[model samples]
Target: MSAPNIPSSAQRGKPSAIPGSSPAPVPGPNRSGNTKTSAPHQEQSTAQSPQLISVQTPTGGGAIQGIGEKFAAQPATGTATLTIPISATEARPGGTPSLALGYSSGSGNAPFGIGWSLNIGSITRRVSKGRPQYQPRSEGTFARIERVTHQDGPGNVHWRVTSRDNALSAYGRNSSSRIHFASKGNKNIFSWLLCETYDVSGNAISFVYKSEDDQGIDLNAVNERNHAILRGSVGSYFSRALPPLDFDYIAAATGERIARSVVKEVDWESLENLPEGVTGPLYQWLDLHEEGLEAVFAVQGGSWFYKRNQSAAGTVSSLENSTLSRTVTLEPTKVVNRMPNVSDTEKPRFGQWDVFPPFELWPSGIDIGNPNVRFIDLTGDGRADILITEDQILTYHVSLGYSGYGAPRSVHKRTDEERGPRVLFSDVDESVYFTNLSGDGTSDLCRVRNGENCYWPNLGCGRFGVKVTMNGSPYFDRPEAFTQKRVLMTDINGSGATDIIYVRSEGVTLHFNNSGNGWAKVEHLPSYFLPPIDTLASITATNLMGNGTNCLVWSSSAASDTCSPLKYINFNNGIKPHLHVKITNNIGKETNLSYLPSTTFYLRDELEGKHS
Candidate 1:
């Protein structure tokens, strides 16, 4: 009847909908059948073009006062938009008062209202935004208080301090303070200091030095002052007043008393406090402790006495200079107690090193560090056993795994006088090898000399059978070259049987063993150049690469300083072979790895020196 009261394009600020185009509005409720009609004659327009929906009351006086879009066309695909103009009256059907679209209370079809639509579970009140409220903090008796500004929030922050706790220890206390004893980690001394905890603010000033005659200084007042109260020279002659004693703080600060302790000097003839068998005059010093002061008297001759907490009686202890070195020629620089602070209650009565179970030295009187003692495996077990040669007897200690070793037992004896080897060769011309020459996975002894070679097959349990004389070989022809270090035994060709390697200035000769009795094969690898005899330290044959074939690692003597030029020669299964030779020059000593036992092999890893 009234053309649906649609506004003009100019008034709505948009172009009219196309005649046959689809309504591309955003997806929402399909309010097609929900449109309202006022009068019986107000039959809904049946046109398929886009049109506005208008509502009227039963009296037909005024229609719902607003403009709204009604979907009369088909929906299509495209970005769609709708301009919702706020209405002063009812804008859309089912919308609340002053609202364009109605909101449902819950999942069901409930009508819209002015109240909040979101069902916040059991919450009945609305959430409003405001600054958080905090309960005020109680202010205690503050020694020093100040207002600290807050970085955030509205008001100026008011901060208060009650008191600062005193330091429990003087570990980091200032050296200038009289009450602050000299502690270990005082950085002011410029000395190297180490500590678990340190504070640069100095010790929390305490009342130990505070005086009552003069106005008593509070903890805050003392903390505010960092300079020393009394400054002067140290020792017997001081430019200022003497340092305050326990009760002298008040007198010292006010100059009320120049009281001093009685000084006494005793002659050496009256030294009745000396420990038994100890000579004196012992040098005395006051040593400070955490709990109290201690009087210490020590001497360079190896005796010390201590009186703890000013006690009348003192304790005496030995400060003997001890060493762990095996040699007696060179004197040690200094003796340091590594565990100096270990309490007496934690130490054994005889000392930690006095007696160790399971690892006790055998034979009772023998020195374990004796050069004649050797650690090796006579048995097939992986653990190392002990071998001691004294007089002419060879004593063996079988390893019982980690539990320690079995009792010492005699394994063998030398028929050629206890001096060494035979009188003809001497010890220098004899080289002995402990290896699996018999191919039985057990080590056998082989003695090689300039004139003759002997093989003693291991019978088991550290016992050997009769010695078999080996055929004379040209490898040991020179008595000078037949020394113990000139010969090396190893598994050269991945065979379980051991092989012998004879090193000389000219080259190296490798001999393959034949059933632990004789040499089956021999190969000579010429040296690229002869190594300097004085600089040559040792030549080792070990399975460096973990491969079955062993490698020759020649090292220079420790007397050589400069880098030793190295040449590597790999002899792989007798194929294309290479040799490694190192020549050293005078400069710095190189660490010799020959000290490592022959029973063990050095593992060659990727981290090995490229030149080695």
Candidate 2:
């Protein structure tokens, strides 16, 4: 036997006689050209030192496998030997899993006609046990968490969370603050966040955790980091993927608050049927439904009709409509609130003549009718009962839901300092109204007079609490400057509470109810939504568009008393955002118009339904 023809370390990059190389040359005394041969080693010598090694793929590299191997390179001069020792060993620090190692040998064209190689270790991942499965949850009163089904690969998924209502109360250190969207992949692991929620003021209020398929568990730092995140003390460490929300707008859009001053218009001349002898000064009122606002007009002769704005078959009919699906008798002489005196210039003009039409006409179960005779839901039965202010006495009639109203009982007796007794046909005093300022679904009393606003909460069972006077603001400091006619005590944001809608020559300003006597102005409708009104007697507010938003319904005293229900429309008409006021004419054709802030939009030749 002789040494094999192999290259030295100096020829490393060039192809040489390696164990796996092709067409290997055998080493012998009678073979090959410049190859040198040496006699077999007289005595074998061994040298050993500890070395760390790892096997990796083409992607990136990994840490040491913590296993060991031994090899001896054969030389062309003397016979060489190779050896591999297999043993069980612990996985390396920061390594993936435990591995088993082994080796194999074979005879080939080597100097001693033999060769050897080590087999790559096979990995056995330790399966995690007793891990809690993912479960969806909603915490606090407004924070919610749901699992995300969309996954990146086969391993794990993500969870999503959203905070609404008042964001400040969504999460904190309490149990209500912990809304789990997913359990950890390993029961011992802490939480991992994917996103976060912020309030209008840009403060983090909630976290969206990720735990579906993740296997990595950080036992030391993750828990503290997660606690810091929930506390909102982490600063802006994590990227804020979700933007802050305009709570007022979101409340209205999500029906969390009342849609304020959202008025819609309807022209009486557009309807199909009209009873004979039906003339001007017809009593009009608004009917609210989930779809939008419906305007009903009652002729003095017990004949009435309604107009609805349906994108498809919107029409004027005395028969079944959107809000009034059932036909009922119209008691003309029973209409209690008298139209306001048009000759009185200083008296509030809008909603003065608007009576809280019978609950049969307005299904919202709200007493947004006559300020004097209120039909409100003092109880949460979803039915309106009677609350009337007459002869200095306040009375109540509770609704039995499926049944009718209970008997009338006296709730309060007004003092002599209060306004005078209002008879049925007397002018409607715009300064006083019955609304749910407390948002308890019961009717409360509101009086705006001499630059001050007073509210009396409904204490259930027809009882009244002590009177409260709202603090003055720049918007409401001087009642004389804007007048009671400019103020509307209605729920504009769908907050279930009454908000202040102040109509000025400039635009409609909103004072959102703080759940107390105070008001906060979040946003307002621009000035373009001026309905044609000489007095509060001509304008009324209700849900006319069937979108659950309150809209203004009114008619011009100079235009044959023809009703124009002004639908509250917010749109970007060319230059900037303005209210998109849609008017339905007598022929049932819609005339689209744009209203901007600080501008009073009126009907013009270009704004006619025929032209549309």
Task: Indicate the worst ten consecutive residues by lDDT in candidate 1.
Answer: 247-256
TM-score of 2: 0.37
lDDT of each: 0.37, 0.39
Model 2, range 1-612, lDDT digits (tens) per residue? Answer: 121223323323443232322443445545455666532222222643333323232332332121132333334322223333343322222111222222112222111111322232111112222123454343454656544443443223343545574332221222122222221232221233323333444444233323232122111111111122334443455542222111110113322122233443333344334321122456455442222234455544443344333321222242233222111121222222333321111223322234322322222333535655666666545556776666656666776543445666774453523322232212354466677766645566666554456666554555455566665533553445657656667655554567776666555555767554466754655555454334433444554433334544344444443333222332111112112233232222333332121110111111234223
User: Which segments of candidate 2 are over 4 A away from where they belong?
Assistant: 1-281, 288-292, 311-373, 388-394, 400-430, 473-486, 503-510, 521-537, 557-612
Report the Cα lDDT for residue 209, model 1. Answer: 26
Name the top TM-score candidate: 2
